[model samples]
Target: VQILDETGKILVDSGVQKQYVDVTNTQGSWVVTTPLVANQKVQVRVKVSDGSLWSEWSEPGWMKYELPEKRASLVVGEKNSTYVKADGTLWMWGDNEFGQAGLGTTGGKSSMAMKIANLENVIGVAVGSNHTLALTQDGRVWSWGYGYYGQLGDKNRTYSTYPTPEKVPNLDSVVAVTAVGDYSMALKKDGTVWRWGGSSSGVEPQKLNFTGISAMAQGNPRNAGIVLKSDGIVLDFQGKQVPGLDGVVAISQGDGFSVALRKDGTVWTWGGNSYGQLGDGTTTNREKPGMVKGLDEVEAISVGEYHVIAMKKDGSVWVWGNNRDGQLGDGTKTNKLSPVQLAGIDAARIATGKSHSMVLKKDGTAWSWGKNESAQLGNGTTVNQLNPMEVQFSSK
Candidate 1:
C-alpha cells in the first residue's frame, strides 16, 4: 500500500517497509511522519496479499476533513466545541469541563486536535447552555455533558464525565431540534413535538397535536418554544395552551417581553412590557399579543436577555427594546421603541447567545457584535463589541 500527495509525490510506500516482509498475506498501513499541511494533497493505495502475487494498488482516496467551511455547521458547547465542513468530519475546540469534549477521559478540555471520542456520522447539532446534542442519520438524538436539568434525559441527574453519546428516549423520529439555555424541544417528522427538562412550567399542557409546525421559537431555560399551532395560536410541545398571539412565524423572548413575527411581516409583542420591551408603539404592556403598528415586514428576530434584533428580507437589521449593556447592537445605550438598522454591514443569518448577537454573511464568513464580556464574540479578547467583527477560525 502507498500514500501519495496530490502532485503525485509518494507520502507513504508500505511496499518498501522491512516490517511488512510477510505483508503479502495481510492488510497493513504505512504511516507518514512528516508534517503535512492541511488540504496539502493526499491519496492512499492498498495492496492485498494473495499467495505469491501482490494485488494491484487500490483506487485513490482523498484525505480531507468535513467541517467549518462555506456551509459550516457547528456544535458549540461549554467544552468540545465542534463544527462540520462540507465534507462532514467534525472539529471542535473549547473548555472541556465535564468531558463534553468527547475525546475520552484523557480527552479533557485542554486536550489538542483529537477526534471527538467515539462519535461519527453526525448530521445535526444543538447546544444547551451547558450540554450538547447531536442528531444522526437514523433520526436518533445523542446527548453529552451536564444533565442536571435532566437535559441529557438519563432520567437521573448526573454530570456526564466523558464524551459518551446516548440516544434520547422518546425521540426516535425527530426531524429538527433546538437546545438553548438549558432545555430542549424537537419537532417530529409527523409535526408533533416532545420536551423534557425541569425548566418547563411546573405543570405542562396536554394534547398538543398539530398537522405541521411552520416555525418555532424558544425562550430562556425555564421558558419553552411557543409552537405556532395550526389554529392560529401558540402551544407548548405537550399541546397545553400557551400565551401569545396568532400568525407568528418567529418569536424572540427576553427577560421582560416576548416578541413574535407574523405571516404578514409585522411584529407582535406581549408579556413583560416594563421598560418598553414590547415595542408595541407604546410603553404600556399587554398580556395578549398586539401588533407593533408602525413596523412591518420583519423576516427573523432574536431576543437577548433584554433586547431584540430583527432581519428584513432585504438584508437589513433592526434593534429596539433593551439597550442597557448595549445588547441591542445599534451602537448606543438608548432603548428604542422602533426597529433600527445596524450600519456598515449586511446580515443574512441571525443567532443570539445570552447577550450577544452573531450574523453569518452570504460570503461564508461570520461576524459577531454586541456584548462581548465572556469572549462570546470570538474576536480574541473579552472586550465588548458594539458593532460586527469577523471571527478568525483556526485553519485546522
Candidate 2:
C-alpha cells in the first residue's frame, strides 16, 4: 500500500514500515497506518503479495484531506437540529414530541446530539417542522417522524408518528430532498421532481411536469416550493417563474418568501416580507425576485419562518429579519430589515429553523442560538443562547 500526493510525492509507503506483515491469510484485508503530511488531495493504491506471487497495484483512489475544516451538512427543524459529519454519520437533537428525532421513541427532548440508531451512509438531510428526510449515498430516501398526511411517503393513509427511518416507497435514485411543513419534495437523478404528503394536493407522491431540476426548496405553506433547474432557471412548483433570477446556483425558501444566490456572488429574494426575511432592507413584499441589498460574495443561504442567514464566500455569516427570540445570533433581539454580520466566527454552512439558527464552523464544530425552550442548542440546558453556543454531541 502506498499514498501519494497530487504531485506524485510519496506520503506513505506501507512496504517500508512493514505495515502489511500479516501474509498468511490472503483472504483477509490488510490494514496500514499512514500520517498525512500536508493538506491536499492524495491518492492511495494497494498491492498484495502471496508468498511467491505478487499482485499488481490496484487502482488509485483519490481523496481530499482538509483536516479540522472538513465539510458537513446541517439542518435545523422547528424544534430540533440534525447534522451529517464528513464520515456520513447522521445525528439529531432537541424536541421529539412526535418522534421527529427518529430515535424509535417519542422522547420529550434531547439536549445532547444523539446518533440516529443504525442510520449510516447519509449524504444529505432535511428537517421539516415535525419530520425529517435523509438521502443516502446510494440514492435511496429514508424518512421518519410525523407520518400524518403521508409526508413520510410510505403510502399509509393513517396519521401517526414514527421513531425510526422508513424507506420512501416507490421512490429511488433520489438525489436531493426537503421536508417542510406537512409535505416533502424530492429531486430525481433524471432531473424530474416528485411531491408527496399534504399540500394543495392530497397525500401521495405525484410527479411534477418540470424537468432539468437541480434542487428544491419549500416556501411558506406546504404547497409553496421553489425549484432550481440545471439550466439556471428558478421556478415555483406551480410553474410560475421567479422574475429577475437567472444564473442561480442555489435556492432557499422560508415561511412565505424565497432566496436565491446567483453565480456572480449576489443574492436575490422575493415573496412575503412582513418581517423582512427578504433582506432587501424593507418590510415590503415583493412579487418578483430582486437583489438583497449590500451583500455580495455570498456562498450559501438558509431561511426560517421569518428570518434568513447567509454564509459568504469569505466564510463570514450574516443574518436579517425577525429576531424576537434572538435567532439572529447578533447579541440582540431587535429586528433588522437589512443584513447584520455576526462577529468572531466564520462558518462553512448554516441552517435556520422557526426561531433558531445553526451553523457548522469551518473547523467542524456546531453552534446554535435563539429559541431554546426545548434545548435545541444541544448544550445540556434549556436556556436560550443569544449568541453561538457550541453543541456537544454524545460520544459514539
Each candidate: what lDDT?
Answer: 0.61, 0.84
Q: Give the TM-score of candidate 2.
A: 0.81
Instruction: Give per-model TM-scores.
Output: 0.66, 0.81
Model 2 CA lDDT for position 105? 96
Residue range 1-396, candidate 1, lDDT tens digits: 666878878866655544456643454545443434455557866756544676677888887522233355543332233455444455444444554544444233332233454565566776666666776655677777666566666564343343566777656666666666656666667676666655423112122455576445566665545677555667654666655466666665665467778788988777776556777645677778777766677787777665667778887777777666566677777787766778865766676655666666667666766665444455655666677777656443
lDDT tens per residue, model 2, 1-396: 788888888787867323345677445433332435446899988777655677898989998865454357898878889889887789999989888888889969989899998887788887777888998766788988887777888766337788889888778778898887777888999999988877434556789889889988886554467889898989886787777678999998887788899999999888889988888788999888889879999999988889999999899998999999999999988998999899987888899988999999988899999999987888888998889999999996
Could you say which candidate leads in lDDT?
2
Cα shift from native, residue 326, model 1 (Å): 2.7
Best by TM-score: 2
